[model samples]
Target chain A: MKEIWTITRRELQAYFDSLMAYILLILFLGFSGFFTWIYGSDIFFVKQANLQVFFSIAYWTLFFFIPALTMRLLSEENRSGTIELLLTKPISEWQVIVAKFLAALLLIVAALALTTPYYITVSSLGNIDNGAVFSGYLALILVSGMYIAIGLFTSSITNNQIVAYLLALSIGIFFQIIFQMLSSNLTGIAGGVTDYLSINSHFESMTRGVIDSRDLIYFLSVIVLGLVFSESMLMKKRSV
Target chain B: MDIVIENMTKTYGRQKAVDNISLQVKTGEILGFLGPNGAGKTTTMKAITSFLIPDSGKIFIGNISVNDNPQEAKKNIGYLPENNPLYEDMPVIDYLQFCARIEGIAKDKINDKVREVIQTCGISREKHKKISELSKGYKQRVGLAQALIHDPEVLILDEPTTGLDPNQIIEIRELIKKIGKEKTVILSSHILAEVEATCDRIVIIKKGKIVADGTVEELRSQAQGNETLKVTIEDGGLDEIFKALQLLNTVELVDFVDKSTQTFQVKSKPGQSSRRDVFNLCVEKGWTLTQLTFIETRLEDIFYELTLDN
Candidate 1:
């Protein structure tokens, strides 16, 4: 646990030192503000209190930004040969994986937090349900967590940062889009399973102003599966 | 504080990176691992440090089996890889402190320990600067400082002096010698002269196998012979020098190293010194010898002779 925290602290410090956190925050705020105030406002033609615009825009933004943030978590270490130094320390494989995941998760959470002004603007402009907004943010966190896990897993398989980024984006898009399409094409039990596998379905359910236990389980399972695969890859490399 | 490696092997796909190799390092002893490129030197070092596990073998670090409990076994090791990967954005002191934290050093002692290692590695002056801003020698020192921050019983360094100037290389060699007096050190290098100058014993690996293991004297004796003689004569023609030194029956081979200065390296029979014969030959030829010196067979000959067969 101590070792995990040490790694986490270093990783977080790296994000801040490189100005990555600041850039991510600015990008998140700029996009969310443009979508909500400029496009979704009454003056722009699309007037809706549904917040569907915010969710859709935020989700799409993360499809590219999350991979950019996490593509170097493990891949850069391997390319620069720091993985050997880290492995030589007195820490377990799981500790390293969890530490890196937690660090990336925290960065995404901070970026999400920057969207608070958007919520405030929506509230001041008209009547808004605080509970629904809170639930929406919660769903976004879960979705971001799932995306970060996929990015980490992709980063573990290769040392090239560009390859890691592209692979993560492809996998995230597959889970978010293809699974939903497959669910519509199939019927009965097969369709139900496909819908359950679709990340968008679970996230969409949570953003509808209700917290479902099933959606929480789906996101948590994705997180665990991604971390488990990452740990196994590291172990296999070490044992070679 | 002994490391015992028995029949260690590691394969990458169909290629065996580390073949069945075994060796031992006693307490407070420096063992230089000498090998050419792709000779499995780095692979074996990684196995000892538990960064890479062997396919089939047992590595015991102070009686602790690394395969069974790698984390526990690794606590006793401090490894410095060839290309030391440091966080370029962080200051040197901060990086060492981070290393101390991962090693589980107490918070109160971390500061003093980091400082101590920085001083030991001769990087105290550059500790305040970011690693990216430091020179290559300074960066190497930072790597060495981190390796020593935890004060592990075993230190494994792979090509510690790979890209450094002559002065920096000498400084690092002296530092390694000083540190080896108190800790078990295993350093790998292709530079045979550096290994000969710093290590107490050597293990030469070639083509993923141990070709020779012994002290410098033993390796030299096992090679052709331990005796060598160097004679530098005044400016003379090569044909005259060759004719002058070729008359001795005891001289096995007279090698002319340079023609301008007429320097010749004469190899005598095994266990025999050719200084007396060369002196007599010089006297008979009426050659005015400007300089005559005896040279011992160094590790380079042994390394080349052993690896040449492969």
Candidate 2:
């Protein structure tokens, strides 16, 4: 645990030192805040005190931002040959991967935390659905976790950051929209399977204050698979 | 701790990087690894550090098998890889602290340990600077400091002095020798003089296999079996002097090195010395013996002879 924290702390410091974290936070907040407060279909337009507007905007904002945050997590290390230096220490490969994962997740959480004024202001204006607000935040966190995993897996496979970003976006698109489209155009078991694979289906349910075990299982399983694939990629580098 | 490798072999695709090689480094010994490019020196060091697993065989660091428990085995090792890769964006102090923390140093002692290594590596002046802003020599020193922070039982340095100036190389070599007094040190370099100056034992490899392993003197004598002498005599015909030197029982072959100077080169039989016989012959012929110097076989010649043709 200490080893993981040590690496995670260094990674977070690097993110901030390079101004990557600040740029990401600013862009994320700018885009989400604009669409949720002043743009079309904002909270005032809906005439509801619920934070559905913010959650929906954040969902799309994080989808684009998470890949940018994670693109350099492993790819830069691989490119710089620092992976050898890190691995030779008294730490396992899993610890390194987990540390990077936590670093990116913590940065995303910080970005989400910065927008808490939105929640407070909405509650001040009218009676908000507290349960729905809590679940909406939970849904964003879960989706961010899944996308971060996929980004890390792509980063682990290649030493080029651009390649990692593109690959991650390609993989994320299927979960974000392709599955939803395929499910609507199909029928029977195939449609049900596509719907299950669509992250939007799971994310929308959680936003509506529904936290089913199936939804949790779906998100957690994707995160685990991504982490497992990243670990395997790291191990494969040793033999090659 | 002592490092032991038993018949380790690692291949990348169809090419063998390390081909069934075995070696041992006792504590307090500095073993210099010498080889050409792609000759498996780096591959062997990587295996010892648990960075690369061998296709067949095992490595043990103080009785702990690397394949079975790499984390435990790695605790005893401090490796400075070939290129000395580091996080260029990090400050020298912060990077050392991170290395110390990862080595499982006590939280309170991390600061002190990082300071000690910084002082030891002579990077105290640049500790606060970002690694990318430092010069190459300073960067190399930082890499050394990171490796020495935990003061592991074994130190593996691959081409540690490759890019340093002459003075910096000497300083680093002295530091390595000072540290090797208690730790098992394995350093690889193609610089023959550096190896001869620092290592207690030398191992030379070619094409993924060890071609020679011994002390400098041992390799010298092993490569040169017979004694040779360049003799300069006066008041005697060069051809006659050569004939007289060759006729001696100890001398195997003799040739006129310089006819004008009356210099003759003589080669003795295996394990034989022709100096006394040649001197006696000169006295018997009433020729003045001006110079008789032994020709020592150089390390370069030995390395070339061993590494050539394979």
The candidate that achieves the highest lDDT relative to the unseen native structure: 2
Q: How well is candidate 1 docked (DockQ)?
A: 0.70
Cα TM-score of candidate 2: 0.97
Error at A218, model 2, angstroms: 0.9
True contacts kept of 1: 0.88
Stretches of candidate 2 exceeding 4 Å from the true structure: B233-236, B255-264, B283-291
- lDDT of each residue in B213-306, candidate 2, tens digit only: 9999899899999998999999987778777787899989887788888887889999999999988998899999999999999888888898
lDDT of 2 by residue, A19-67 (tens): 9999999999999999999999999999989889899899998888899
Candidate 1 interface RMSD to the true structure: 1.1
The per-model lDDT (C-alpha) reads 0.86, 0.93
Q: Compose the digit string of candidate 1's lDDT tens values, residues B79-129.
A: 999888888889998899999999999999999999899889888789899
Tell me each candidate's i-RMS in Å: 1.1, 0.7
